[model samples]
Each structure stands twice: as C-alpha cells, then as structure tokens.
Target: MAELSPTAGESNYSQDIQVDEKLVPKKGLSLCSTRYGIALIIHVCNFIAAAQSTVINITMVAMVNTTDHQFQFNGSTEQLPGGPNNAPDSLPAEAPTYDWSPQIQGIIFASAAYGMTLTMALSGYLAGRVGTKRVVGVSLFASSLLIIFSPLAAELGLISLIATRMVQGLVQGSIFGGQNALWERWGPPHERSRLCTIALSGMLLGTFTITLVGGLISQTLGWPFAFYIFGGIGCVYCPFWFILIYDDPVSHPWINVTEKEYIISSLAQQIHNGLLSALPFIIAWVIGILGGYLADFLLTKNVRLVTVRKIATFLGNFPSSALLVALPYLPPSYITTMTFLTLSCGLSPLCQSGIYINALDLAPRYSSFLMGTTRGLANIAALLAPTVSGFLLNQDSEFGWRNVFLLLFAINLSGLIFYLICGDAVVQDWAKGRKLTRL
Candidate 1:
C-alpha cells in the first residue's frame, strides 16, 4: 500500500506513483460525492416531520375545541351553533367544562421527547445491524403512520393522542440517529461543516413550515387535516428515499473512480478507532437541555417579537402575515410564548450541529458514534425540559418563564466555555520530533 508523506521537493507525485490498473479501485459514488444530494433529501424529510410536530402546538386550542367533549373556550360552555365544533350542544356544559390542565398538556408535548430520549441511546447499535438507510427508512415510515393516527387519537381522547405522539417520537429519534450516522459514513472531511449546517438548518425550516401551515389548516379545514397534510407529504418522500440512497460507497454505481479514491484515502486514517471517543456528549447534553428551556422561556416571555417580525419580513411578507393571522387566534399569553418557543427551537439545531461538527473534525472515523452519543444525551435533555419547566411554571406562573431563560442561558454559556477549551485543532500533527516524523 502506498502511504502519503510530506516531502520538501516532490511535485507531480500523482504522475510518479505507478500501480496496476486493476489494483487501483475504480471511482464510484462515495459519501463525498453523494452527501450533498442525499443530505438534501434527508433535510426535506426532517422539515416535514418537524413541521408536523410544531404545527400541532399552535393548533392545540382548535383541536381541543373540535374533538374533546370536556374542552371549553372563553369561560362560556355554550356550543357554537355550527363550524368545527361537531359535539352535541345537549352535552352537559358546565363551568370548568374542559379540564385543560398544564400537566395534561405537558404530557402531550413531552411524549415524543420521551421516546426520542430512549431511541437515540440505542440507535447506533440498531444502525450497525440494519445499515443507516434501512434505519432511516423504517423509522420515517413508522413516523408517517403514527402522525396519520395522531388526529384519530385526538378524536378518541388526550391519552390516545399522547400515545401516538410517543410512538412518533421514537420514530423521529431513530430518523435523526440514522441520518447522522449516514452523514458520517458518506460525507467528506472538507464538506462536513457545510453539510452539517445545511442538514441541521432543516429543523428551522420545518418548524416554520409547520407553524405557518398548521395555523392555516386549522383555521380553514380544522386541526385534524393538518396531520393529514404532513403525513401525506412524508409518505410521498419515502419512495424517493428508497430510490436515491445507498448505504455505502461500494453500493453506489454512479460514483467516479477519482472521487472514490479521494474518499477512501481521506478517511483511511481514522476508520479503525472506537466510535464515541471524539464526541462531546456532555456538552451536547447541556446544550440540548438549555436550548429546550430557552425555547420555552422565549415562548412564555415574548421579548423578541420586534426582532422576530423583522426576520419574518426579510424572509417574506407571506410568512409574517401568516404569523400575524395565527397570533390573534391563539390566547394572548400563548401568542408570545409560541413565538419565542419557535425562535429558540429553531436556534437549538444550529447549536447542536456546531457541536457535532466539532466531533467530526476531531475524529472523522468515529463521527457516527460521536453523533449518536451526543444526540442520545441531547434527547434526554429534551425529555427533561418540559417537566422542569412545568415544575417552575407551577411554582410561579408569572416569573417561571424568566427563570427558565436564565437557567438556559447559564447552561449554554457553560457549553460555550467547553467548546472554546476542547474544540479540535483544524490540522493535526500526528507525526513529530522523530527522524521519520521530521520528514
């Protein structure tokens, strides 16, 4: 095997190295070659799934009004004569008719997170056995089914909705895990940073799309139809996934010989080590927890509406108008709460990608494992966020949001410290001091 070595005077090394034509591996589609395209598709899928998740938060009021027997709005038990409220008017309508407890709502919101916490821990093991493509495919398929069933659960009861959400959460976790693994396997070292940015950015897009679409759908066709739309979109993407993706470079026919050589040579140095060594899982945990709380804090505090509006305007007038239309329909308290939540949630993925990309930089071979570990730890944070927030909110509803924000900020600052201290140097000097090393 020919090994690369730095030399003082050698130029045109590519021409000097002679090998049997048969021995030189032919160029083929590799992680480096196909990463951008595959990652793009994965991002699209993630966005659809994420949108479904966030959209429901906005539609909670509409959903309860339409489906639940015990739900009431504005202190009046009187049923609307027509519209989405199909429940019988004769049903006993009393004061405190709908039991919309924060605990119950927390359970509904937290179900997916609980599943994510569990699945992310085990996803690496599962992906090792089934391959990343299968893992992602199966998870997305199951999630699509669960999302389709979510509205049905709403029709049944809050418990049923929670159950479906939990299932969906598990599937979502698996998708995230598998996607990360796939990227590590396929992405080139040079492109890892940009690829991570693009892949993670999808979460924001997904959140925005879901919130905007959910608001529109809930306003027009009612809340259940929102799930249908998201689910349908997910299903449509599955076939494309199946057709376009391959598990490894050897499996892809479209890759060229030069690209394959580049990928193998680039990754050859790092593939033999253990998978989790380079990951900053602890940092990820802190970031995830703080990010979740920050989002909740923003949702509850509403301090950045002007900034948010400017952002929305820069993006487009349609999205800004959509937010305005949706805000009035929501309870005044929730409007600001959800807005901040959206921004915070959107920001978390970027933070996560930044941390995970560092792991790849530190150990390219073990990138998948590091990503999985970090993701698992982060999911735990996601699971705990709602519960902690609930506890604080219960103690003092007025000031609890600020407390959460403060806590999140402190935690994130700590993570930033770790990042500064531990991030890998861009170029590693593996050989130094020895006679051969000096060469």
Candidate 2:
C-alpha cells in the first residue's frame, strides 16, 4: 500500500499507481471514455427529476380553475330562476367549492420540505446499501407517478394533494443525497470536480426548462399537460439509467482495465469530509459550472487540494455575506436590491467546488451517507427559510426585509467561519470506519 507523505497534500499517483491489465485499454489514457458517459447519464437523471419537482408550480393556477369551481372573469356568478340545471338562465351543474386559507395554502406549499427534512439523512444511508443508481432511479420514478396523478389528487380533495406532494418531497430528496456516493465509483480521480459540477448542473437546466417551457406549456396545453410532460420525461429516462449504470468501476461490465484501475487507485486515496450547505437549487447551477472549473484549475497548479477547496469556499460564500448585509440598504430601486441579491446567489458556486464535494474528498467510501447528511442539514435550512422570511417580510414595510437580510448575513458568516478553520481535503479516519480526528 503506497501512502502519500503527510507533508504533501497532493496525490502521488503518477509514479506509484497500479492498474489491472484486464481493465486497462491496450492503447492508453483516452479523453472519451465510459466515465464521461456515466456523467452524461447523471446529468439527464438530475434534469428530469428536478423538472418534475418544480413543474407543479407552473401548473398550480390551472389546477385551481379545472375542478368543478366557477372562475368569474366578467361578472358575478348567480343562480337564476328554475331549480337546478333547468333554470332558464343558469349555465352548468353545481359543484362543491373548497376554500384556501392563507394558512392552508402555506401548509400545502411547505408539504414537500416537510418530507424532505425528515428523509434527508435516511436517503444517503439507503444509497450505500442499495447503491446510488437504484436509490435515485426509484425515487425519481416514484415521484413521476405522484406527479402524473397530482391533478387527480387535487380534485380528490386537499388532503390527497398535500399527501402526494409530501411523498414526492420525501422521494426526491434522495436524488441529490445519493449523487456523491454514486460518483464515488463513477468519477475518475482527476475528473471528480469537472464531472460532479457538470452532472449537478442539470438541476439548473431542469429548472430553467420548466420555468420557461413549463409556463408556455401550461398556458397553451393546460395544467395537466405540464405535469404529464415533465413526469413522462422522468419515466422515459429510468430504463436507460438502470441499463447503463453500475455501482462502481469493478461492477461496470464495459469499463476498460485502465479506467477501472485508475478509478480504484483514485478511491484508495479518497478521504471522507463534509462542508457546504444548500442554496435554492436553481441558483446552484452557475456556481457548479464556475466553481468546478476553478477548483480543478487550482488542483493542476500544485496548490494543496485542501487550500484550493477552502479558497473556493471562502471566495464563494464570503462576498455573499457582505452583499447580504448591504442588500436591505440598496437604494429603494428595484434593480439595485435585486442585483445585490442576485450576486449573493451567484457567489454560491464557489462552495460548489469547495465544501460541497468535500464529502468525496474526505471519504470516498462513505461519500453517499455523508452527502445525504449534508443534504438533510440543508433541508433544515430550506425548511426554516420560509418561516424566517415570513416573520421578517412586511407587505408594506422595509423593516421586515431588513431583519431578514441581517439574519441571512449572520448565517453566511457562521458557515464561512466554520469552513475556513475546519475544512479539509485529506481522507478522514472515520471514512474508513476507524477513529475520527481533526487535523
């Protein structure tokens, strides 16, 4: 067993690395390989799942109008002369109406996170046991079924709709939770940052597709089509994913000898660690693209991988803290405050390459479990954001927003400090199921 010197944080694979001839190609290191294909598959999986997750938002308005309720656009809806449908002037059959209290609507909206928060860590554990591809594949396929039935659930009653959303939330939470674990096997050592970033960027693409395409679809085709379209996409992708992917290099039938050996050797040095928190996913895509490249670029320069990780973390999150602090004060202009907030969201990418992938950096073996734990922690933040925002937002007052921004600043500051001193790139002792320590 070759071991890297304690003093040097970089890998020493070039000289000492060994490959199994059975798995290695006769030719040499090649750019286009089975690994990149897996990355692309991951991209599609995230894209479909994410699109399914959010497509409901666009369809909500349409759902409200579809079920036997009267939508009055021009004049008051009044019952006229005769009894029932025979009334001389009246138009259709009378259907029951449901009321949406502000509180009830809030509950319905929050139902997904309720499930997500509960299942975050559990999802990761499942990934290790069953394999990440299976876990994510099952989750998405199940979520698609729920989404397709969503309209029916809405019409059945409020309870049914809420139940459906909660289940969807619970199921979808694991898609991301399992990614690090899945990649633990699929990504080659050198390609970890690039591949993780690229595959995860699908979340951004998914959301963008839904927001722009979903809106148009719902408007022209009706609300049910939106769900059907997105859900169907997920349904279509599942078989392809299962057929193509495997748990790790050793398990993949098509992976060549060289690639397998390289991946296995890479895993030997992979350590387990954790950092980074969740941001609203749409905002994460840009960060993934920019941060992934930046981290990989720095790694090539001989900067200690740990230092590179921290730099990405600090660069990504610290400015957002400052920007968030000032956001409330941005001269009452629409664009000004909005711009500040956008930049704050934009800077989040630094952490994508930074602490986000630290789980893989720390412990390649347990990456999925740690990734799930991180996601669950992020879901707590996601769960809390609405409540805190509600408390600080005043429909007519700026003071409410001021308090919110201040709270955000504090949260970012806390994370920044935590990652700066404690963040690491070295493999962790606990990742190997041994004793744990901080260096």
Candidate 3:
C-alpha cells in the first residue's frame, strides 16, 4: 500500500520535516484564525441552508387551508378535518391558504429532497472541477433568491411553490458536497472531528431555531415572513463569504504560513426538527459538539480511530432506533413523547463523529465525491419519508405515525449493521495514490 507524503503536494516543500508538538506554531491557530473563520462562516451558511430546507415543515400549517372539505348542516356549509392545526377561524380573513391534500403536502415537503437527490452528486463533481468558491457561492445566492420568491410562487399556484422548492433544493444540495470539498483543503487531521462537527452542528441549530420560531412567524407575520427573513439572511451572507473564503489555505491571502503548513500537514490524515417541535434538535446540537470533542479526545488518547468511529456510530444509531420503535407504543403523553424524541435526536448526532467523517479518513482525495455520491443515494429516505408518512397517516393517523417510526427503526438498524460490519477509517488503496489537491 502506497501513501502520498503529507507534504508532497504543498508548495515549496521538497523535503519532509519532523514537527514537534511544541514547535508547531500555536498562535493564530484558535477559532480566530482564517481557517476556523472559514469553518464558522460555513457554519452560518449551513444554518441558512438548513433553515430554508425545513422552514416549510412548520410553516405549512399556516400556508394551507385544511378546511376545503365541506358538509351540509341546515343548508349551511361546515368544514371537516382535512388536515391538522389549521382552521377557518384561527387564521386571518385575508390570509391565503391552499386547498392541498395531505398527500399533496407530502409531495411539497419532499420536493426539495427530490431536487437534492438529483443534484448532490453532480454538485460534488462540479465542486471538484470548478472549485467550491463558485459552486457553493452561486448555489447559496441562488437558493436564497428562490427562497425570497417562494411565497410568490405559492401565490402563483401549488405547482409553482413545489417547483420553487425543488429548485431551491437543487441549488442547496451543492452546499453539502461543496463544504466537504472546502474542508478537504482546510481541515487538519487531529482537528477533524471538532471542525467537521462545528460546521455541521449548524444544521441542528438552524432546524432548532426555525422549528421553534417558524410557526410563530407564520401565525403572527404570516408564513411568507419566515421565508423572507431566512432567505434574506442568506443573501446578506454571500458577499462576506465571497470576500473571506478560499477553496484552500494556500490561496487564502489572509492565512499565515504557519497555519497553512499546519493545515496541509494535518490533511495527510484526511478527514433536525422543532422546539416543543424544536427541543430534540437543540439537544442534538449540544450533544453533537460534545461528541466531537469526545471523539477527538479518544483519538488523541490513541484509541483505534476505526474503533472510535464504530462506537460513536453504534451509540448514535442503535439507541435512537430503539427509542423510535418504543416511542409510538409508549403512553401517549407530551412528556413521554418528548422524552423519547429528545433522547433519540440527541443520541443520533454522535454519528457526526462516526460514519459521517469516515469518508475523509478512507479517501481524503475523493472525500467530496464520496460524500456527494453516498448522500445523494441516501437522500432516497428524505424523498420517501414524508410521502410514505403521509400515505400511512391518511390510512390512520396514530397507526400511520407508528408505522412511520417503525419503518425508520428498521432502516436505521439495517444501515447501522451494514456499516458496523464494513466501515473503515484507513485510507483505501486507490485513494492513497494521489496527493491532496483541488482534484
């Protein structure tokens, strides 16, 4: 098995040099430095992208008129249960609501995932070919623009809204692969868990914040504001991103040589829903950061890296799946439901340190491509999850929700078992051939 020297691809480095822990420059290495700054900004972009992806989950309640079905009572029309939560009296007289079926709502919800599935792999390829700067930057800006127009699209028609959301998904999907590509250049080996988790924890926080406030925004200012506020934030963020971010440390003028060397040398090693509706995610975010720290701690302690990854994967998947299986059967109480859900969501993030970062270890050179390909296929779940739930729920709400949970449990367990049996952290034979570079 051959491996590229850590410094082989870096500029002006013809010979290998030993780096002492004490000798490695430590100044300008904290969160204040350029690389960390990039991570933080990527965090913000993730926050925006994730918020846009899910805001409709909460806001749809206000967006749809569930009272389309009518009944006769003394020649007066009465509305029956078309969906949950929305009622004629609860919303403003002028407020718009679509006469969409639960199944239609499912399609709307899943549309973005569908779009994401289509583009994720291509986005990864483009990121590698053209650079993440253009791919991610243009995608973010386009997604934001789409988000701002989402309400208008809804007003135009259901098809318009779904099309808009799907387009948003297409563009935003690039972000996942693109960000990973960015990290391939910028992330250090030892700091892999912490940095990756920090960037990803934004998704949880974004979900938490949007789920917590999205409904409130819908009820008070109307659902459009939810779109406007979040979309606007993404638009506002683009200039700063373009100005501050570079695809790799070498190209970043602001980065000092010491940090650049540290990042490149380290590279050799490679590397949510709502309050009340949001509770689980906030817990997950906290646990995710903690899990990152724990993973890094174990790595530093010389734990077999693959072993650490597996343990985290098991902790994340097994318990969470078990809880999902048990949740529906539990006594129907708010506290009981929340407890299982909170625990499930919280534990699931441990995988951030496990299966999530395994690609970087397995193939630093192809990490972005692997991420895009795997995630694109895995998005089949996202594409089907809501639609399946909707169909099942339509059959029977309680039983349907139960079935949904059970199905998830089965799927997650299967994936956990497969990965436990096969996942590896060591670099692969083919991937080891190339030194780290743009592609």
Candidate number with greatest TM-score:
3
Better of 1 and 2 by lDDT: 2
Task: Summarize candidate 1's per-residue lDDT along 37-153 as a digit string, tens digits.
Answer: 766877787777666556556556454433232223123344444333343243323201223443355456656765674566456556755677888888887888787777677
TM-score: the better of candidates 2 and 3: 3
Ranking by lDDT: 3, 2, 1
TM-scores for the candidates: 0.53, 0.53, 0.56
Scored by lDDT, the top model is: 3
Candidate 3 local lDDT, residue 210: 82
Instruction: Answer with 1 or 3, whichever has the higher TM-score.
Output: 3
Whole-model alpha-carbon lDDT for candidate 2:
0.62
lDDT per residue (tens digit) for residues 324-399 in model 2: 6775454445445445655676677667667866776676444433543454345445435645554444231235
Local lDDT at 142 for model 2:
91
Tell me how candidate 3 scores on lDDT.
Answer: 0.68
lDDT of each: 0.52, 0.62, 0.68
Poorest 10 consecutive residues by lDDT, candidate 1? 1-10
Query: How many residue pairs clash (N, CA or C atoms closer than 3 angstroms) in each of the candidate models, in the order given?
Result: 7, 12, 3
